[model samples]
Target: MNGLSLWDHLSVIRDPCQQWKIELKLADILFLTIAAVIGGAEGWEDIEDFGHDHLDWLRQHGDFENGVPVHDTIARVMGMLSATKLQKSFASWMQACYDVTEGEVIAVDGKTLRCSYDKGKRKGAIHMVSAFNAANQVVLGQVKTSEKSNEITVIPELLELLSIRGCLVTIDAMGCQRAIAKKVLDKGADYLLAVKGNQPSLEAAFNDYFRLDMFQQEDANGYSIQEVGHGRKETRLSLVMEDLSILGDLEYEWPALKTLGIVGSIREERSQPVKELDITVRYYISSAQLSPKEMLEATRSHWSIESQLHWRLDVGMREDDCRIRREQAGENMAAIRHMAFNALNSDTSFKAGIKRKQKRASRNTEYLSQVLSGLGLS
Candidate 1:
């Protein structure tokens, strides 16, 4: 929060509180700015600790709330802020922080705040869908959903708010819905949907037709094939057709179906090396007319959402261990963690995970200031 420059830039977009009181605006900004700097801050106590520790620097930077609102005041104001309005404003604020590169691969994934579940009350936990730019390693945006609703519903809602015109969206099987595909196309982006049992018939048909047309070269259109293996898994593949004919009588609207393929793979782990296993054939549909190399790149890049983003959150940022579950506190804190993740990743020269980056930031104020400046926060 030492840098008020980013907050000042966000203020220009729209009044943070045309509906709420001005005190609430100050409290919200102060809380979020601090949250961005220090992850895992929840409620008044955490913010108070942050303020107390950073008081001198915050005062020097004009980032401290006037008179340093007490913990109770901070808690009350946070409780009063409308969750919907705050989410919307925060989404807008994040859009201005990073530039979305053209043809960027935006990976969409969901994670539940495990501690948000109240077992005594039998209430469900908070679930959120996050859109991360795989190329830049930045979290573009996140949308919180009701505990009972699946991410399929929330993903589309989050997608509707983004501008991914030329980007290729990579999502897991949970997001492989026709409606979701249409929404992505409607937003002027392409999709690389993972085929799974959720769409049983579609998955079955794709597998069937792909196997039938494997070596026949039925379509005169462009086609290529490649095989790769690393670690413990090896994949043998063929991409044959380039038309909707691959979908064949499925009755799903696939206006963007341009490529079809069969991905066959075998796995042999260190513990089970003797028993080589051949998994079921996997299928995929892409909107982009990509070459074999591009398809492989897109497919491999999709896993970064898991390895780079989610793994970092769980291990590096300790997201799964968070126990804050009051109103929007869980959702808000998750967004702050993502913000920190992006900030740390953007500081590529740091050459370490979030925890180490934070330690470095905490130990070196000048370096931390430089990071904030890079984020347009200073």
Candidate 2:
């Protein structure tokens, strides 16, 4: 039933249960939990229910000698496991399953688990910063922080765990710091970071340069496209300038800085008046010398982390609806969801959206096997 077992990678995570008291094996628990999540299980109870329903199928991959553990046992074991170890395992499994090609865009962004907060403990909701492969639609790795502001710290840690060489790492305005840019360069990759009010001087410089209408110049690379959907028409203009002279020594602060980019979007709803049209302009700094088209594609690809990864976790997986706020259970459960996502998204046999695939997998063990095929289990 398997070739490249995810359990081989998961072996790095130490079981926290005492030897004498252990009823269910760690492999049994992890495999059951992962398979359940892949079948749309939202919480520990769902995971246990899935385990009982699919015990025979699960037994094919794992011993399940003691049968499926109770929901509380699953919760306790998952809570006791180290999140860091699980994350490293996830990263390793991803490397085994997906390869990052040269110039591939990897988007880094953060999402908050809204229901993870525990008022009894006076703890706030946790924010998870994830690195997603835009081209592959897979999650590479993630790091959890207590607050969104800590994403600045968590991002570097997450980057340290990935094989991002020869890739273009993109992030939102929150990741435009000099250290972050240098981290990307040091990792043997390039960065395309958004510039906003956080970096006041840089944002001001971009505003000043763009005001001159120099994007029309012959030396600058430019591209434009129009899209019609969702009852609106959108026109996107992308511009890239390789000349760093405009930065006036500010470029020295950013390591290997080579290009500046701007993407301006004008959208008007079909029912709205022309005067009511909406326009947005975003600025970016990149170490990669990308063309206008590449810049546009890379920037647009950055939002895939939000639209594909984060949105799917919340809606398809029902992550925010679960209130598992004890100890490290929430973080570890999130890791399982990422694993499930990588499996479901990487499966080519299913030609449907994530939710549809989940529903099919829940009803048909054959389709579930197809999903596990990505993890080297058929």
Candidate 3:
């Protein structure tokens, strides 16, 4: 197929013309979509400049049909698109471009577009919940939440939208609720949740039961422990305690509490050394009884959501500082940015930072076209 013909597949899902009364063909819309993201088109005007500058190359690559629409048309079409419809279409595209891996680690995290807040209107910024596949580095789906609601309320809805069978789901303290744990189990997936002040009773029970003195006692069987201090942080650890007898009197049924742990870390600066300690206890509810290595691997995989996904989107891609707050445009644009980031990350040859990759693609139309072609978005 030619570079732009892939849009025909997506057109079956949503017709831009019917939705927005735009006269452009699917190819034009697809080009603008890819260009807007990869070209660093902050808004409609940037997309227009990108299209106008790349017109000759676009025409050469494939049939232009009615030719590229002006920037105003691009803005109008994007503005007119129903956010819900766009999200659905994006989800469909994600499922098409990527396949869910068996035993995949799907991490759920929430982010707020800081610049998306409209202070004049006294409204909260767009806060979105994103589910990411840690292994494949692909976004599974995203849901927008009202400013007042926390991630706890939206996480279940996001999980309901995904097919997570055989996947390991990880979440922060906010999601460490019984209802959420039941939801994960009901979906045929295992869960590893971090304990914090929110579950004070559970935290204290786990801590008191696994206190340091308890490990030094004669009854510490089938339990191994290890500790590490690096970069001015101290981490305390214990492993593979098959028995939960110490936690017998807890009011809640923690059948999933196969292994419990506590981590404390301190930070030191040039001027002063600040001591900070956090007592975190977690429950590992899995279909497969994992060995110590397997459990540790799964627990460590949690940081991929931060290192591979969130960190990249914020620091690498500058997503947090984006100032596009028109209706759902900010969230919609952020989703597109994520799609672009995944596509770029999957391309081994394009190995620079996201900004550099985007600049290189924008400066070289052939490279940009090739990247989009691989994504089935040409």
Candidate 4:
């Protein structure tokens, strides 16, 4: 597989084009798309422009026998390609590039690709469920569902494809299902699932345990952290109880339920009045037995999927602004963004943010080649 080069790793996706009608190769198109996207190309035209401008650089890795295809042809072919095939190939490529460490936190979350919705076609927006390796700051894999509610069903499916053994998988309350918990256990990984109103009895149990009058300070381990940043001062307190007797028979329902945790956050913005300050508490259930400090870190680490993956895709890459809603195009393009993000984020030599790194890559072919080299290209 050419040491898992972008072209070789993605070649496993069967080409959707008819053999007799084929001009541009599938690998060539995908390689160009991913590289161009990494180099700050936003849409089909931008990708085509990038290809024409860097044909020589691209040819070093892919066989550009038919030259760069037109933007319309690129869009047509990309829209016809199978998103599932691309996702699988993408996961395989990630596995080749990065190794998941034992006990690492794998945050699972969903994001809506807003502009992908086609009101004319009566198709809703595409919601992507992604597994992000928090410590490594890279996307492990992703699956797209037609509706946000479908995340519960597809998350387990996405988890099925990744090598998550010995990792701690964290999800918000939407994924706090017993089946999902069991699935995580089955995958040889532990789960740290949030608890909310959806699980009435479980939420009540956690509430009762921490109730002001009934709470026993000695029964739980506690940790606290404070931060001052972005014109705000915040403090977080994490409390975890390892004793399952608190749940009585309710504990029997959750698979490998070893600990229960809660995080209380107090925030004060510089511009906000005292009354406008924020204070909130969130609950979680976990299969891993962790100390109060470890629980606090793990719970906080879960948000990296938002700040790192989702936020970067939206703000850094302008993914939500892209209006590519053609058949399978939205989903495939999302995968390409993830691929580009992984390459950019994994390259530590630049010592700059993703946006800056991308800008540099777009202007400097040498820096761009360094970025591609991280993906084992050339």
What lDDT score belongs to each candidate, Candidate 1 first? 0.67, 0.87, 0.67, 0.88
> What are the per-residue Cα lDDT tens digits for candidate 3 across 67-119?
77776676555655566655665666666666676677788888888888889
The TM-score measured for candidate 3 stands at 0.81
Q: Sort every candidate by TM-score, greatest first.
A: 2, 4, 1, 3
Q: Against the hidden true structure, what lDDT does model 4 obtain?
A: 0.88
Q: Per-residue lDDT of 1-378 in model 1, one digit per residue for the tens?
A: 223334553454343344555553563455344543453343457667666666666555554555465676665555444555555555565566655766789989888878778888787888888888888787778888865347888888889767788899988888888899899999899998888899888887776665434434555332334444454545444453465665667644665767664555444554455654565455677787776556666777778988998888888877787776666667766766776676777786778777888777765667666666655554
**Scored by Cα lDDT, where does model 1 land?**
0.67
Pairs in steric clash, model 3: none
lDDT score, candidate 3, position 334 = 75
Number of the top candidate by lDDT? Answer: 4
Better of 3 and 4 by lDDT: 4
Q: Lowest-scoring 10 consecutive residues by lDDT in candidate 1?
A: 1-10
Summed backbone clashes in each candidate are 0, 0, 0, 0
Deviating ranges (above 4 Å) for candidate 2: 1-4, 212-220
Provide the lDDT at 283 for model 4.
87
* Candidate 3, poorest ten consecutive residues by summed lDDT: 261-270
TM-score-best of 1 and 3: 1
TM per candidate: 0.83, 0.95, 0.81, 0.95
Predicted candidate 2: what Cα RMSD to the true structure? 1.9
**Would you list the clashing residue pairs of candidate 2?**
none
lDDT score, candidate 4, position 205 = 86
- All predictions: root-mean-square deviation over Cα? 4.3, 1.9, 4.3, 2.1
lDDT of 4 by residue, 125-213 (tens): 98999999999898999999999889989998999888888999999999999999999999999999999998999889887877532
